[model samples]
Target: MTNKNRNYKPKIGVIGLKGFPAFGGSARAGENMMFYLKDEFHFVVFNTNTHTSRKTGTYNGIEQIVYPKFFIGALNTFYYYLRSTLHCLWDGSFDVIHVFHVDAAFIIPLLRLRYRVVSGHRARPQFAAKWSWLVRQYFRFMEWLFFKMPADVITSVSRPVAELFQTRTKRKILFIPNGIVFDEKSEILQIEEKDYVLFASGRIIASKGVHLMLEALVKIGYTGRVLIIGNRSHSPEYAKELDEISKSLNIRFIDLIKDKQLLMAYLKNAGLFVFPSYHEGMSNMLLEAASARVPLICSDIPENKQVFNDDETFFFETGNSTDLAKKIEQVLSNRPLAVEVAQKAYERLKREYNWKILAEQYSKIYWRLIETKKPLNSGDSEIQGNDEYKAG
Candidate 1:
């Protein structure tokens, strides 16, 4: 299994969602990883979205496999998972299979019996819960499927996620934080050194807690205008309510902007980056802000804490507007401390969370799994199969 002895370039298959220069952070990570490894390894990227379009053409020199056209939500997700798995199995060309997300991870074992090296990316639990009976059961089932899949390695987006998986499955988990291949930084600087602040990005939905950021702004009496970017297409009603709330509260809202350079231009002088996500495996926006060297105020979650020290990063209770505002105020008023925190946070992000480090870590794991082909097992699969047969 030594690299020098091997004649053929090891074929690597990455099964994930659509990638850049499209949307989302994870997609960009997959894109970058594929581009970087293309010369060294035979790379194939299977996208649930692209497949629906029926385009099998190469993008950036990497082979692309797009799945069938399907409807949105659960149906689309499951379709991609099944399509990617079955395609990899029948093609019988790949030496390794890397499936992203838990839903697809469930199919790893069945595919693993064919492909020797299987790796799955577990971003976050579908339902972030520890108490709900039904939700817990569902997660347990997914977890079981993942462990039983015979994947030699499980990749987590954050250290906390890796730790959580290790606790549940006792399998070695590798941390590969999402990567961002940001376009060239904008030359323009928009924000003047004012009291203005910037909060949240990506889809303007409740889970993102954009409203929480607005409430925080109100609570802190941040008279300066606050800019909120990213669409609310996922929850139009909620977006309408948020707009009404902003108007009633006298909070100014900047219309959503999708351009990365334009977004970076805004980040240039923004006093702070506020991430009010209630739950995250690891947030790409937060990492991007850190990479852009902005002071951060995020939810006081384990993953957030991993990114910054308690002092450097101000965290309010998840979904708590008042606390988020307090944290924002503390950072805004204390200019000297804010700069110190921003510097430290950026340094930490560059040292540990940057794409280069993440890519290297993933490369090590993917290669190692190829070297030692070992599949992990789980108890949930046994229980589920037995329950199904009994029901039948």
Candidate 2:
């Protein structure tokens, strides 16, 4: 955040979204949000020098600064943010700084002293199943620091996350769930409607429950094509386990699809979309599946529940392979029921989670911050949680 006393478009310094092309959920969310609000504000995204070779580039009129990272890929978040913050402080131009995650936002305490910092509490990463006990404990410490720090506004993609942070602090926490822009152009893959199943994650890790899905498919002796899209760099051992279980089944593990249009093509053609993740704040893939009008089978986790109901999307008991198998069979066998569910979920997404509307709401908060730079208190927490946020 920086001073905004000039008569120009308000500038926002963005941190914590691994630079622009936006492969992961956090990065995708940041890119879409800024794209929607490009007319209202100017954005300067702080990226790692490794993100792109171009030291300075533009994505939809957004300025990007690829700052240097220390020790290669390790601790890039820390070095990148620290450098970006210092740049903002020295330049003293940006009116707001939006940090995407708790791990990337340990510097909020320092940033808030000068700028109206908006820290997004996206997930309880400390509970991530992929992390070791020590790593999880480190995430816990980061979360503790994030909540205690003074942020002007906190945005959560899940209502449960917003409520959880609200109980822990008096600062303003807004439950602004994720949204997707429906691709109206038809992208018909040469696959049948119920010929294959689709599962996608940015990283192929244990927390995503891909192994459970593979086991369920094995239990059912599924013979059709199964597309598992993601990279296995996150967990080689777990990925090897997945390969071991998937060998007996018709599983095709595809690398992560970074292009949204291509990903949508796969989603729209899939027989069913399975989301068996054990941890998440909100998922961009789930939102995209809904937009694609595909029947979803998600784990009965609170994060996924916030997006759709039992009738709208099938939910299996979390970590239960048998239940997931049963749900998968039910969705595949009952085509009419699956179609109804997909239609309903898509309608709900359009009504409640439209990206344009959510982007407008966020910009409104930014405008409020620009008008009056101050910390939000408990008294206006309720009023500020919704669209009429009087504070940042």
Candidate 3:
């Protein structure tokens, strides 16, 4: 994109998150939204080298504003948050300012005075065990600003998170779920099926509940090969504990990867895919596993349930190692039933969680904010799409 190519499209400045073309999580969410809506909007995404490590430049057609992210305890993230907000304040080219994460709390009020602001509420970072007590307390205030700030639109990837905000604030919260890009050319690799059990995440963290899977493996005396793939070095102590627990088990550790196609290949080969995450904002990994059509099991948390019911995918009690072990055994022993369940989930992902449909829903919200500058209260209005994800 050059000025002539701009063609009078809406210039939206996106802040918060590491970068576009991201491996997964919120950054990936931003990438999918921009890619799907590229023709209708012009996006200027601010990124941090701490995650992408890509040079500051254009990714395909999108312009990336890159910076280094520091790790000063929990406050380390503040480096990116503070800098990006300040930069957005200075940049006058945007028609709409879309901010992700509650950390942008301090700037939303000011941004609202200048331009239309859309708050992306994805997760509650305060609940994660990695954050210090002080940081958690600060996040609570940040979350408050996220709800209280005068933003034009508030969209949540998780239906439960949206409902929680509505319950507390009595405001209209839009529930726009996360989605995975379907690769039409994707073909299963020549890997054997039911060969091993798998658990993967962006990084090894306590909130992801990897220990639940390990303890379940030991409890069941599972001797099958287990594959634990993620960024182990991100949390050295947790990685050490995972290694210790797997001493008696057959385990293979692979470095965390950003390649979605490669991940789906790994997912397809697994005999059983265990997603024991305790919390999520409509996990992209879970969606990918469903899209992979692999035998799967996930924790019975509200976030996972909103995506798939009991019949769509196997579920174990959250944090219950014994239940996870039992579910794992059930999925492994009855492969035919597991396959049927997996197929159902794949269908659901296509019908409800497809990125094209969800992104179009986002486009609806954006145009309403841009053309009319009117409030789209999802509570009483029909602005929200796909009623399947409506809170029960």
Q: Name the top TM-score candidate.
A: 2
Q: Give the higher-TM-score candidate: 1 or 2.
A: 2
lDDT of all predictions:
0.66, 0.82, 0.81
Cα lDDT of model 3 by residue, 1-392, tens digit: 13234457888888886766687588887888788888788788878876777788877778788887676754556777778777777877788888888777787887877788888888888888877899899889999878876477888888888877786653478888888777697665655545689988888788999999999999999998999889988678888999999999999898987877677778888888899998887788888888878878899999999989988999999999999999998988888999899999999889888787678777776777777776555455747544634332
Candidates 2 and 3 compared by TM-score, better number: 2
lDDT of 3: 0.81
Q: Total clashes, candidate 2? A: 0
Q: Which wins on lDDT, candidate 1 or candidate 2?
A: 2
| Candidate 2, residue 16: lDDT | 81
Model 1's alpha-carbon lDDT is 0.66
Prediction 2 TM-score vs. true: 0.93
User: What is candidate 1's lDDT per residue for 1-392, written digit by digit as tens?
Assistant: 25545676778887765543545656656766665666657888777553234377676778777665576664676677778778888999887887766656567777777876545554555544323577557666776677554366666667776666676664556555665543454365575544457775656767677788877676666667677777667577878878876764534555555456666767766778888887776777787777777888888888778667875677789978888877887887798998888888777666565564455555555566577565434422211211222253
Point out where model 1 deviates above 4 Å: 1-7, 50-54, 71-74, 128-140, 148-150, 179-195, 248-259, 375-392
- Residue 385 in candidate 2 has what lDDT? 49
